[model samples]
Target: MTKPTFDLQSHSLHSDGVLAPAEVVANAAAAGVQLLALSDHDTVDGVGEAIAAGARHGVAIVPSTEISAVDGSYEDLHVLGYGIDHRDPALAERLRAARADRELRAERMAQKLNELGFAVDDAPLAARRAAGKPIGRPHLAQAVLIHPDNAERLEREGHDDVSSFIPAYLIPGTPGYLARTHPTVFEAIDWIHEAGGLAIWAHPFWDIDADAEVLGAIDRFAAAGLDGVEVFYPTHDAAQTKLLADRCAALGLLTTGSSDYHGPEHRLFRTFLAHELHGYAPDLSKLEQAAARAAEAAA
Candidate 1:
């Protein structure tokens, strides 16, 4: 069987995702992914295991991670690092701080939810994953489900999915939202380079504010050493994907695509293959090509 020339971005239990690193890679090989990037949110703890799994399945693994950044202009931004040195001490320290911020934010949000009568304890978020791993809204959402009030609410609303309850109240602009103190976008881009990685603006259309002028922001980010744009993402509708593709071409920026798979509802089985984006093949070759460039530049 021929290997598919595509790289899929995914997360693992190291972050908000449910699967362990090995399970994520196993699913990738099963899904016919030739290349996979375990770009777990704000952490790279799973990259090593994913790499080992890749070797076993004859699939290549690119050590990658995603970081949350506050561009200082936008409400929030996420940066994806490709070909990063997960072992780098500087990179590790940055991610550690970010995860700590996540913990703090979770505490604050849980406090607010309790004020609203959800009465969830912070223990659930801490124990949500392996010890010391970062926790996020998903864990909090699950914690709230165990609360009598929330259980009644979910039953009343007929919600069988925990994630389906998050955005309705926990996300930004909602009752339980608490903004995180993230690194500035420029600092994040530089951190990725310092860690021997190429930085890409990840899921811009989703992470950015709906009313923000996205193209103008992308142009500004390009000046901050943004290497590529995540043009092919599951959340991007066909028209939105095309707009991103055209913007990348106009800006002379590199392009990437991904399933951004987490688990279950966002499984690889249901996600669109990165290469099959409405006849416009996403340029994931940039992953390997930029790997060399990042190393040379960092050296």
Candidate 2:
């Protein structure tokens, strides 16, 4: 298979990703990705470093962020903002506030875990905060896995990694579950537009919500000025990809593809390049044009 030229969604240590920004860019270069975006959750703090690495590696980096948002009852929906001004002061402040919320949520999850008799270490969380890494459920899971008090129970339960712990404890209706508080999808789209970026729904099928609910939410988001949808993803089957692509065409919305690579350590899905996009030949022209316009506006 031909290597993909564009991988527009990824993460770095600024969020929950295992790799640093420069490391992620280096890997993208090695994978023959010509265009990339460091769309860290709720933060663009890694974009500057990734851009520098992209320059050195002859890759074009899009300043981007993946914002956690809600659509009606769907609380964990994400919106990817591309061609953003990473240095925008107002955007930075808003993201900082979002990260603060994440921290609070993490603390509450930790408390919940403790109430359930799972002692999670606070030191690791403090270290992550000191390093400016965003607190997330994965971090909490990792803490649980490492804490001496939970080791026996986790081992007996076959909970060996972060992923195993998440569904068992962190998700809604679980013992450590904490409902997220976030802006509406419309508000998130407006935030992206205000930052001179295009807001695209990220990995619609990846959400726990049903496909019909996702479709309905996307319709609502498109009507609210959402710029596009992530049509190609590792988890999307051929039918799902075709469905999203057709929907985007019908709605006059741009369609984009990405690996959503977190790093080698993430076990959820294998990294895919644009060429691996399921059942569809990617046409990134609309996305590129929109990104160009956003960049120009930011400039």
Candidate 3:
């Protein structure tokens, strides 16, 4: 089992990755990633920068994004849209609305954290609002816990390190929880399809419900025209990966895998595995198939 020459799922400042879009392209080029996709969260804002850098670095940059959507049953489902026309008016509107909601949620969470005695100022929150990406809990974490310039002060004040801070204190339903609304998965698929892109269900293993529950959602989404299932996700260990692969096969759906890289934000799962990790190495052929389909559709 050798590593794939390219990886499709990744991020940059366009979303929550640690590096800028150019840096991400440069790093991937240096790492020998032949093809790269900067699937930032809800935004294709970095595509131009990534494409320009990829040209210089000798890598192919695919325009993509990870959209959070609610399914028919109102469950949160993430759809990875590839080869999207980022300038689509409807798509841009939705992304901007999502960003606005994120800012509101972040402000509410910050206020709540202040109530909890975390000395976190509104400045970091404000800056994130200005940056224009979704200011979710992770941004809050960067604001309050992980900003390296404040690391010593945070440690002296007894703050948990960056990793633990999110899970321990700021997860959904915690004291500072602020829920943000997202379009339904069906709506997302519709938008992506309308924009002439491909939408695939992301990380089946992370589905909150059991396999049957998630399958039920997938079944309904199939009618709305979902392109594939992410059977090969970074979080899916070997057994889970194989299970999803088999399921997608039986359903006659394309199967795919990716590193889900977010640079420093998720450094652990930043590259494609040559062999199985907990049992998954996505077949990149599906990605190529998706590309072909998108091209045909565009034509």
Candidate 4:
């Protein structure tokens, strides 16, 4: 049997992504991904445009979103919802609330940086978001780098992405840190279900340790109605990948392989896309079936 090829995770400018939804679909077609998902952050605002473009490009676009999530044990985990009804009112309301909070947080972070003498202003950030992009730490970092003084300080580094600046300033407990929140994993899973979607736990190894403690945590996630786990992320080492795979199989959970393609616009784009060099592809038949099932269930 031929191996399936798909890239189930990507982003668009509707969130923190650089590419428009249609442009992302076109690029993914060029990269040879026949089936793709534009899982923008917290919004499905781009999915309609992407679905139209996917039809033109002959690539199937999965309408999806990556929901920020929190758990008692995990502060910054994420949940990937596939086959979502992007127009669902409840989902839209939740995302609106989150975006509103993020706006306030970005404003506070900018004020914090201004007080700390970075000379950063909220104008550029607000303007960038005026076009309907997510107001995120990256947008703020880009705003900071726009300052000639800070730009000169970061000049020798030659970095166009915000990877370096985020940890330097915006991480939790850092100077520009603002406490953001997400629904608990349980609540996020319920939201996905409500949207007639399949909720997959995104990148479990992010903060999970390899121990009985982590294994116990996995069990808790399974109990929370997570349909699958992202076992084939680029960051998962060979052993870690196998560990997640084993856990998924043992628990009878669906398995997914995704590039988590953030596109070339990201400062960290070089990092995640590098996984493609290591040969990352997903089983499209499985993904297609899952999408069909979710669509029917949603209908």
By TM-score, who's the top model here?
A: 2
- Tell me how far the alpha carbon of residue 294 in candidate 4 is from the true structure, in angstroms, after superposition: 9.6
- Give each prediction's root-mean-square deviation over alpha carbons: 3.8, 2.5, 3.9, 3.4
Model 4, runs deviating above 4 Å? 1-4, 155-160, 207-214, 265-267, 270-286, 290-299
Cα lDDT tens digits, model 2, 1-299, are 24457888998888888888999999989888877888999998888788778777877778899999876556788999987778889999998898898889889889999899898988989999998878999899999888888879998999999989999999877888888767778888999999988899998998844778777877888888998998888778778888888888888888887888888868874363732565455666755664445445444
For every model shown, what is its TM-score relative to the native structure?
A: 0.88, 0.92, 0.83, 0.86
Task: Provide the overall lDDT of each model, using Cα atoms, as 2-decimal numbers.
Answer: 0.76, 0.82, 0.69, 0.74
Under the 3 Å rule for N, CA and C atoms, how many clashes does model 3 have?
4
Q: Could you tally the backbone clashes for each prediction?
A: 0, 0, 4, 1
Error of 4 at 241 (Å): 0.7
Across 1-299, the per-residue lDDT of candidate 1 in tens digits comes to: 12235655788888877789999888878877877788988888888788778777877787899988886546468899998888899999999998888888888888888887775755666575448888788778878877665777678867555557687767778898887657878888999999988898988878664524778778899988898888877677777778888888988888787877777565332342544365576566667664434334433
**Between candidates 2 and 4, the TM-score winner:** 2
Error of 4 at 252 (Å): 1.4
Model 3 Cα lDDT, one tens digit per residue, 1-299: 34556667787876777789998888788777776778888887887777778777877766678887765444346888877776678888887876676667667887887777666745766675677766666778767774455567667766664465766567665677655556778778887888767788888777654777767666777778987777766567767777667777767766655677777446365553322434334555645554444334433
Model 4 over residues 1-299: C-alpha lDDT tens digits?
13335767888778777788888888888877777788987788888788778777877767789887677745567788887788799998887776777778788888998887776756777676787667888778888887777666567656445888887788766787876666778887898889888888887776666656556767888898888887777677777777777787789877675677777655444223333213333334656865554344434
Model 2: colliding residue pairs:
none
Clashing pairs in 1: none
